[model samples]
Target: MPGDSRAATNAATVLRTVLEHGPVARGGIAGLCGLSPAAVSRQTTALLRGGLLRELPGPADGVGRPRIPLDLHTGAVGGPVAAGLHIGVPSSTFSLVDLRGRLLARRAFPHEGRPPAGLSGEIAVGLGRFLAEFDSGRPLLGVGAALGGWIRPDEGTVVHHPVLRWRHKPLGAELSAVLGLPVRVDNHARAVARAEILFGRPEARGSLVHLFIGNVVDAAFGIEGTVHQGPGSAAGDVAHLPVPGSAAPCACGRTGCLQATASDTALGAEAVRRGIVPDPSVPLLVDAAATGDPRADRLLRERARAVGRAAALLLDVFNPALMVVTELSSVLDEGYLEEIRTAATALSHVCDDPRRIVIPHAGPAVLPEAAATVLLSRVFRDPCRSDERARSHPSV
Candidate 1:
């Protein structure tokens, strides 16, 4: 229903409250959301009717009647699901996620040369094959694509991806046309940050920074449980941040950029150049370091320092409550993380406890899960809004 701003805000608040503390009583929701029981009941009724929330049976205690709890209708195995797609430089991944961001299925495909003109169609076919394994009784909410480089989420276009040589690609629209589903697209690192905010342990809320350290070096900041997507969704473009004491050249034809020094590509190339590893790959370098190879250790320490410098710079600017670093195996070492902490503390004018920084070892499945969380978060953020679109399609 077309409603006033206050009503919309109330509904959104109730939905988020339920998502965060579901299987909870309406009275508890009212207290948590700062709304009266009557208001919460009204909003929850609307949500239940919209098929976004379900009521659980109340406990049969020997005392008075128990109040039924309200929760997001996401636990059902035969309920609706969302398709997540990630287009990276080396490979593409697809995953199925329920409304709560739980992974149902995941698959990856590696490609070489360049992305073809019919890449969207190819991905759509792959998703179709992946979906065939699941029960067809479940409805599909939409597809969320995570691409590297600049993205305009509002327009669902990838403005630029130098790694993939893609420019001004209407990826979301193309994929949507192929699959007959709604599509949303954004930068891969930012998408991962969104997932961290939505599904991470210790429940990362308030101010947070997520750093992705692999083939690319990018960061995303989450404030007040929402990612700080700046104008044009280009807020976390820290790849070009200048790094001191490094002579590496950046892809932008510049010297000493963060990506040139801290990225896995840079580390791998340096490992091969220094004869530490015959192959230029992160896994090989990490393996060599794990085996106590002095040369590999030296290279990794150098890269770790560079990443520390970048982290320091970010801390100075954002002063996030916590910083989550991904793909940095050396983070397990107190000495290694101390290097980052020391640099950040020294460089950042606003100092906080260094222990706030953490590294998440999510393995290869992180990207696919990140892509799916992009769609899942939207539902949690505004169930009423997304439910409208879901109602239109009913099933996909």
Candidate 2:
């Protein structure tokens, strides 16, 4: 209920702890968090009264004791309390997710045009529409905008972006004001890395590089379960890594860049070069690949090689513990995918640990949902310092 600071902090921690690792014993939670059993009981009682957590129906293990394993009342915390947004150049997405990261209701729509505010405006509007459409009355603890470009968390601005055209914009502040919710903004790639750390693999907590492949190409670094957001926040802009022999041109006017060599759009452009304007659609490309179209096969394999080369380059420099490559889920063959693994394994120290290089299957959910992971992380990590700043400032 309407508690003060100390109570709030304790309550939040207890709730967060249970949400993170549930079906857990109350005494066990107290011991793990270094809180007294009484303190744990008080917080649990408060949370139970608030309907944020509940005890599952069951008896204790072993002989005749009882252990009503406590859990986040999934019907409540799992149904609401957090919402995620994935913003992009062409479209934006929104979702209501529980503590376990289950999607309750979600919406996707095309951006009308490139607004002066870039994603700031579209995300605000799209989220409003999504909430109204779904009639989701859940408290929106945060709004996370995941998008491309160079985002500097230290400065709280999108330093520069070719895709979003957002430069030095106070994206986090602007949207928080409009949506009336604390917000967390991060690079799409970093979000993918966070997703892997929190949901994908606990081992990825150590040093790792998240090489994300999709309609766009980029990479992010993770250490000790945290994405290495750079001095400003421009850590994963591998798309601009210069390619010595790129045949395709980049949107940034660069003659040779990784994105120019490997992005799906880059592959589709090859069809035009061959004098065939394939219709613009993801399903169309997938259909071609399933039907064994030689051109699609060649494009996919060549693109996989470019991705492999990028991984090798990063491994040479970062020497990360692992590399998780995110790509389209429909991709079932490793025709040249092995070339990437072979390159990472042979050129770097990844051979000893086969888990070093892995491909994470992704679909429309990869880029955007990854963006939301940063928001969820803030609550679990530290109540979101940036979101706290958003709450304090109220305006940029």
Candidate 3:
């Protein structure tokens, strides 16, 4: 691993490799990372000096003879401390966590209005309160803001958040400055996909796709261990896809869009029209379904059919090894998962094993998992190493 400018960044990767899949042997790390023994030793020394990692409290992970192993000191200042925020249509979740993808503290803030500045202020107050009350004296790392709609990751800008009426806002810079922490912002489903990839299950590290059917119905695909963030970061917006027979007008003014037929808005509105639920909150409708309400059951079944169809299309395009879905009601009530399974199975082309589909409940750890994935990107492709290595290459 030779390059242009980021010797330190490459060094960080060496440490992360050991910290992540390490305590492994130095030769193993050098072999996997393509660095010589001397290079690995140099990086390891720098990391130990920085106090980011230390020898494991036990015997080494030696290739032949016993050797001393290395591991990340969880209590290290710069060790973990990443945060993630998921802003939904009506509610937003703010979380603080560590590198191990554990949730230290999290609080959900329900949206009351559409003023960005005021809402930001209130959210800031909430985080400050959390910091004063529970944030350990350890150094704070960066925060990741996860929201719906088209988000430009490199620029840290939100091109459009239809639900929040946020257009061309520097959400990343603004929130980072306000909260006094580094920021990483991206599409909500992508952030959730990050969580699924890193902390959900070991198998998820491979090619996978995550479909989040909630306030925002979006899908993200991870191929060869990397989430495909297409040009302009629009790899997963299938809501505008004109699936036949849906019959509802979407924000794009398209007919039969999936969102019109499959979103919470569609289901809740349909249930309300039939006088089953009073509003467009799908969770409440799901509550009714779980209570044996015939009308709610009917609505859920109909919605599941449409959602499964959308998932089928996604599977055809990505052909991922697994699908991790986060559905609102199904998480709260395990039985509702049967309905989701009915829909997915009715449409999926995944081989005979349904275990390939994992529906996990949303928990506090979801946020940190999202933030860590963003940081984890740099761990895999050290920008610092790439820069320096660029110089090592013969010029064209």
Candidate 4:
């Protein structure tokens, strides 16, 4: 490898080591990441200079300065922050997160009655206001925008989003132009996968599959800590994956598709059709179920089983170390997750251990943290490049 590339890789290694085991000494970082002490020192110096890492006071037992602990600069002041934007069909979420992907503040922006053509502009305006209200003079790294679609992250374009009616839209550039900050765009499925690998379970780094069941249903796969984005970055399109025992009709003239059978949209509509909820809203259905509505609980369980059937197919194919399900009811309630695990384990020939399937570690805060991971992931991969990109953009 080239000299610069090797240095960047070493820098990322050191950064991730500290992220996993922070407030640790330089020698500990070298020991954890298997790098030489000199290399660890070089990267830590650069990271501290870049304001990504900070040095805490050394032990008072007369230990040398080299033994001082270091951690991600997550202090109340001067610590850098990343902005997150999760654009769902019905609403958008804006979040401020620190280096560790912790949510500092968040706001929801509903898109009711907004035209598809002008939706991005409206979101930009609302997001700008959100940032202004939450800005505490911290170093704003940039924005990471995640949504359901065939996204080209490298080009920062939305190749296709059926729900949003977006095609070949330069979403990242538009948002950056309006917000005057660096913006990275990616599919929410992959974003969640990356977030899991970075901040969730340790087993996720070995291998994992993430299934997202929101207004849209999609999946993402990761191996060896890297999420896969196939040709044109459109790998996670599981909307039409067949779900066994489900005969729900899909708009594509197909029946038993995963999205049609298990997505929040389908579940909400089913709840409304059953007179369990007044409107097609997953949250309302969940609320009803929580309030002892048996009808709503049964509907959620039915969708959970359908999601499990689809997850069974994925497990049989990939057999990843972990299978993360990001669904509203399942994340909020363990009963629904148990239903999914039971159904998946029953159907999956390769996976009998229900423990392998779990909800995202962040739970209710999953989308916001995952959206921000779109940019935070880049920062961990190559902090130098991310810093340069942030420097190019106007400070928030």
Model 4 score (lDDT): 0.93
Clash counts per candidate, in order, are 0, 1, 15, 0
lDDT of 3 at 145: 76
Per-model TM against the reference: 0.87, 0.80, 0.83, 0.97
Cα lDDT for residue 251, model 3? Answer: 74
For candidate 3, which ten residues in a row score worst on lDDT?
A: 382-391
lDDT-based ranking? 4, 1, 3, 2
All candidates in order of TM-score, best leading: 4, 1, 3, 2
Better of 2 and 4 by TM-score: 4
Tens-digit lDDT track for model 4 on 1-396? 498789999999999999999989999998899999999999999999999999887899887857899999999899999999999999999999999999999899999999899999999999999999998999999999999979999889999998888999999999999998889999999999999999999999999999999998989999999999978787989999999998889999999999888888888888889999899999999999999999999989988888899999999999999999999999999999999999999999999999999999999999999999999999999986664544566451
TM-score of model 3 vs. true structure:
0.83
Predicted structure 1, TM vs. truth = 0.87
TM-score of 4: 0.97
Better of 1 and 4 by lDDT: 4
Off by more than 4 A, model 1: 1-5, 62-66, 113-118, 201-204, 328-339, 360-365, 387-396
lDDT of 1 at 330: 51
Q: How far in Å is the alpha carbon of 93 misplaced in model 3?
A: 0.9
What is the Å distance of residue 139 in model 3 from its true position? 2.4
lDDT of 1 at 239: 85
The residue ranges of model 2 lying beyond 4 angstroms of the native Cα positions read 1-20, 30-52, 58-67, 76-79, 112-123, 154-156, 243-256, 275-283, 329-339, 349-354, 361-364, 383-396
